[model samples]
Target: MQHFAQYDGEWQNRAELSCLLDILAISSRMDLRNEITKEIERLTKTLVVFLQNPNVDRNKLEQTIEQLNQLNLTLMSSSGRVDQVLGQVDLLKCLAQRNSIPGGSCDFDLPAYHFWLNKPLAERLQYTQSWTADLTPIKQSISLLLQFIRSSASPNTVIAKSGFYQQSLDSSQPAQLLRVSLERNAAYFAEISGGKHRFSIRFMLPADTERPSQTEQNVHFSLHICQL
Candidate 1:
């Protein structure tokens, strides 16, 4: 079996094989562990409330919560998409069984799963949307979450093991942008010739940041683990 890399530990030590383990060494390169932890905590609480709420529709609640846990942010960027699809199948089966879906089959169809094997992630999302009717909010929310998951590349875009955002670097001579996708194993990294740079770091700023002066390079920007 292929080993998947993941965020592990309190600070998210990045260890391969245990894709879910926190990455320890990268914490110092950028203050990633410090910043993200809070948001993760917040999301955890939100998930708890969402699941525990007495009034929320149970089916919708379960579906949304399932994706939050099922769509592992770190798994994208690798060829382990099978697991994600399997997770979906499992989710669907559980939902079918619970709702007493008329034709639900728990034995699992190997050929049908194989049919889904080659579908592109984006196409898979579209297929899911088309397969379900649009009347209920539970279906709509779960479908939307699926869209979010597919929008993120399963293998992240970032090629390097870690990312850093340093705004103070001289704009004239620039290094490459390091990009990491939350969707998958796709990660991008930067290589610099020589220099210790002091960076003014910001974490998960609102999308409406001031645009760079026209003179600034219209280069791509990525949020490094340290910076975000």
Candidate 2:
């Protein structure tokens, strides 16, 4: 969706086509709908427990739970695999097949796709809307879940001595995600790696034509151990 937003004005409609292919590939591998439903259920249960806590904001908690409930209902109403509707579109199926090969989706290889892309912007957008309508539920669910998870943890200032840092994770409360924030103009970037028990971060200098080496200077950044 971000890509779609970024390239919405262009003639190629690359984002729209790529989005379709991504949805098809993802849905073919697993039951994404079921996994999202289960995650929503789990998060909802966790939020319900917070409602009784005096320190937590009841109004906001209730609102989030309500949103989750609505999203859950929308997801439940969406029948079959998420890509089932997209798979029925012949043009998209052909495009997906040709997209796997280098230079395979050229105008000569897919005249139909070329024709579709050449349609008026309004017509192409309308078709894009219809093709992606069924994916709305899953998209909204993921957006909300991520929003909540990211906000669950507050950022803390931490320093990595000699550009390296390591921390042990609590087994009882494993993190869903780890976020590292640095100054926009900083010369170094963070490389994070981890497993269930621990995580490490290394700040490396950017190199254009050579391997990046870790900076020897201490690096300070904001870290968020997001758990929900």
Candidate 3:
């Protein structure tokens, strides 16, 4: 949705429709609302424990807890799955069915969709907003959860000798996410692979027509092992 908002071109309209269909398909297969509600409840309980610590920021902690509470309530109060409501829209239902076929959404295949895409920007946005309204709670909850998880760990400077690095993970306290940050203009990029017990990173140079090769020189980068 954020990406779809960057332009008002015809291609952007196609992308917006694609995004909506993708979200509906994925959300329909899982009990996303229930899962998010449970996660929020768990996070709120975890945050409440920090309130007793003198070193913690009480104001910020309380605010986050309140936000989680509101999100949880909103999820609980929402009547049905977001996909179920969206599936009722005739255009979207047709789009969903035809989306599996190659070139199935072309102008001749879906004239109504083509016509809708050519609608005025304001009218298109109005319909898009209405279609996405049910998704706001899920989006907000996911964004907040990601914010908390990403900030859970501090970044540490690490060097990959000969463009390779490996580390064993503690099974008792496994990491939820691993983040590697490098300079924007750096010549090489980090390729990371991991499992329950260990992880590895290799810096590789990009190639145009062939497979990328690992850089022989040591690479310095910041790594974050987010456990929360």
Instruction: Indicate whether candidate 1 or candidate 2 has the larger TM-score.
Output: 2
State the number of backbone clashes in model 3: 0
Model 2: which ten-residue window has the lowest total lDDT? Answer: 2-11
Weakest lDDT window of 10 consecutive positions for candidate 1 = 13-22
| Model 1 Cα lDDT, one tens digit per residue, 132-206 | 322123223335443543443323232222233344555454423333323333232233333435433222212
Please tell me which predicted candidate would have the highest lDDT against the true structure: 3
lDDT of each: 0.35, 0.87, 0.90
TM-score of 2: 0.93
Better of 1 and 3 by lDDT: 3
Superposition error at 136 for model 3 (Å): 0.3
Clashing pairs in 3: none
- What is the lDDT for 116 in model 2? 81
lDDT at 183, model 1? 30
User: Candidate 3: what lDDT?
Assistant: 0.90
